[model samples]
Target: MNVLSVALSVLETALVFVVMVSVLVAAHEYGHYIFARLFGMGAEEFCIGVGVRPLLTWGRRRYRLALSESERAALPMAEGALDAGEPPRELNEETRFTVRAWPIGGFVRIKGMVPQEDGSEVRVPGGFYSKAPWKRLVVLFGGPLFSVLAGVLILFFLYWAVGATRPAGTSIEGIVRGGPAQAAGLLPGDRLTAIDGQPVLEFYDVVSRVRDQAGRDLQVRYVRQGVERETRLQPKLAELPDAVMGSDHLPTGEMRRQAKIGAAFGLVHVALGPVGALAEAVSRPQQAVVGMIAIFERKVKVEDSVGGPIALATMTDAAVRQGILTLIEWAGILSISVGIFNLLPVLGVLDGGQMVTALIEMLRGGRRLSYKVQNAMAAVGFSMIVLIVIGVFFVDIKRLVMPSRPMPEFVPIEAPKR
Candidate 1:
């Protein structure tokens, strides 16, 4: 890539990453903000980002009851009091606004977030601790629940925007020499009709069937030269390394040899119906848990497995180079992953924190705990998450810095001279 083009790519990648992270963080904060409002707890501030002042301000808005004439008349005095550099005679309780900041991570600073002594003179009714157990539960759970929801929406947009692969009739586009298909005389231009007796619609479906039926005979039906035929072929059992779609580390020759399974007959549909979306949302968490366990067990290495923003962009760029269908495949994998990770039960950070509080409530007989303790515990959990994010960032850096493997040299088949 030229310098300018490369720069553009980097900018695009950064933009996509920022959008993903900011949106996820905002969704999480919104959960807390919404629930706090619902339960009548006053949230003093809701801001995104950590350290810097916001580059721009979008003032918060709330529905206000119309003021009586006397109250309206008092507004000018209140304004005058502030303009005259004097404290307002009394704080007006009517108008409240949420302030948004430029930084992505945010907080819902609710009243009485910490505990107070029972006999303390400084008790506030709107304190977080004063809220009922159910209300607290909802408030705590909302952030992570919303994170998952945001992830689902992201996945949906990814699918809809990037588009899903339509499954067309399976046709052999290329062959690997000495491989089982090649050994069985499977050649380019042959349309695969069925696997055993089942009709085959897409090449990927065929791949799934073949992988499952390893070492077994494949009673494959194909059409060639305007004639339909059947051939019994066995897929060779060869160990393949774990890799994501459109990875560049794949053997160039191997990649070149593999058939392109593009332009399938049926559309890869994503139903926007509530049932489908909810099903996706519910299933994502389980998938994330399974994936996490697999990674922890070393069944999947972090390098070969996970992709943060950099990796995602690298993959996207590579996929775009490869073709459109591969991009869709990557989108599917990323979507499932985003869903799963948000559902983790790690306390204090987001969903996991909510789960933790719920579990604590269950143990404590439904009594509200000190909000201070809860917030403190959550802070610790959030710290842990920050550490993990740092680790992932390093991992991403390593991948970016590591040089890719050199493409292999291949000998060409000599055609017979006339």
Candidate 2:
């Protein structure tokens, strides 16, 4: 690649990564800040995005909302306040909100999150540890909850923007090799509407009718590209476990004769009402979580499927070529994944682990863990997190240096077209 093109790609990747991270971090930390505020548990500082340390020393790093003329007039007369063209903050006495130059990512400082030098949690009125265990649990769970909700909202917007995938009548996903459906010329994308003129609207309508008609010729009506047509096919005898043909849950090694015209069903995109869109959106995160969990039992290996920074950067660059919507959809998935990752009980390293502790405290009637035990768990969790990061980075670096298949060299704009 030309130096300029390569440079631009790097810049694009960095910008997208920073912006997505900021959005997700803000979504997560905002939950904590809001619940903390709701419970009257003070937050000391809230900062979003990153900036040069030098810029932080400029004209007015601190500011309060200019709500009304009277309030504006009553504003504090700090030295050099509001001197610059912009002061990127809205201030409050209890909690400070500051925007960094980059305007991406977030960091929060809440009262009593950390213990004092004496190794005792601050028990002040608005302090975190001072609250009841149940309140603390809510505060802890709030971050992941909002992250998941944010993902759902993002996905909802996506599904609304571009209709959701759902069953649209009955259509073929696959035809069993040399089977009745194949012999009858039933093809993928052909929407079957009826069997022997009986209306077919649901999945079971086809299944029930086909299974009972072994060796019987049946007329199947289907729509393809707005044209209605008919085909005749006879169900072939197939052996299945007695469970489906009968009522037993166990197979008992007994094969039952079942009428079958083998084909897999297909899905089509359909416009969703608001409620349907929300329901579908909610399901995506659940599916994402289950898919990730399936890694241990059934899913693909991490190196094969999981994407680290390099992979994300690559996708971001590609998505940038496609459009903003692609980026938004990707961000939604990433947000959900990050949220789920945090919910893994990793003690000091993740909110979920701390939540488990809070739950334990609540269950035990507010009895807290000892400093020693807490510290030990924290150390172990931190180590695990470090290992995870290292493993991901290793996989990324390996792919870069020794890709299984040779990657085409990036060509500059000036390069001759093949």
Candidate 3:
């Protein structure tokens, strides 16, 4: 592609990423806002994005009510001021609803949720800190919970509308040129019937048989254009680089050997019923949480597994190219990931950290930590989070700028002369 095309693609990808992140963050913060309001906690500001000044503000009272004639006279009158003897217009109490310039995420600032630097207690009614510990815990938990819930709903809609991809039978989608499968005359759309006299039930079965029989000739039976065919081929031991292996612990120069037939395929899409869709939606979050735990446990390499915003944009671009369904599915996955990340107990500025602090306060019989101590701890936590983000950003930039070596091309076998 030309430079302009590349630039446009990047811009589009970035726009999509920003919009998705904004929506997800808004949903998350809305959860906090809603729950806080439910518990009568005062929310001073609910806004999308983080910056010193907001570009736009809503929910501000448009008119002053119950103004005396003297006070009204002092105020500048509009083009259509109240007529003689007209009572002042009544407006609901204002909450600062804003959209800030930076679009990297958002927050709902609940009053008295955290101590200010001035060390003054919020003794006002409906202050977050003045609430019961359990209520505070619920308020903190709301953000992540809402994120997960949004993911689940997205998954359900995608499944219901576009169906879920699943293995139906053994069918090849594409073959890598010069690979064993291509050498054996396996073509796209061919359905594998059996291997080594063993019937193939699904695509995974064919993969397993090929892997198990690596370096050994295998009698493969397949159907193409309603005709049965057989071919004998040996699977190759392909060297997979770290990018392909997807393991962080693997040294940069290291490569892992894997049995390969050099074929690419996917399962058929099966339309799901409402129940099935709901089940799939529920399972996605569970799977994401489990995968995150695996990453934390070192079962998955951090470099290979964890991704920052740049990585997400790249992935989103690829998904968009695939199709709308795929993009929606990716969005759901990302939402779940964000939810789980926020619930990790390490960062004091995050929901999990707030919960931990609240729990400690509860254990201490309602005695709260001093503002100075809390602020110091929060600063430390925020610094840690920033450092981690910077590290991940660098990693993402490196990965993007230094492209990994491409997979070895398959060389198609030459046809014998007649």
Query: Per-residue lDDT tens digits of candidate 2, residues 1-418?
Result: 8999989888987888887877888898888878877765667777776665323422222323223333234334444566763333334435666667665456566667875545446344356776788998898888888888999899898878786655444776667767788788777667889999898886657766777689899999988777888999999876421223212111222223568776777667777778767776776576666556655444345675566777777777787778887888778887888778778898876889989888988898987777777888889999988988898888888888878544322222232112
lDDT (Cα, tens digit) per residue for candidate 1, span 121-157: 1134444655556677778778766766666665555
Task: Give per-residue CA lDDT, model 3, range 1-418, as digits (tens).
Answer: 9999999988888888788888988889988988987876667788898899888996652222233343344334443554544433321234588999888889988766667665444343456776777788899999999999999999998888877877557777767877898788777777889989999877667656765466999898988778888888889876532112112111122223457787776667788888878877887676666566656666555666677877887899998788878888888888888888889775478898888888888898877788777877788889979987988898798788887557656444343222
How much does candidate 2 score in TM-score? 0.64
Position 226, candidate 2: lDDT: 76
- TM-score for all models, in order of appearance: 0.64, 0.64, 0.74
**Model 2 spans with C-alpha error above 4 angstroms:** 49-92, 99-105, 117-119, 165-269, 402-418
**Each candidate's lDDT (Cα)?**
0.58, 0.70, 0.74
* lDDT leader: 3
* Clashes per candidate (backbone, < 3 Å): 14, 2, 2
61, model 1: CA deviation in Å?
Answer: 3.6
Error of 3 at 224 (Å): 7.4
Model 1 residue 213 CA deviation in Å: 2.2
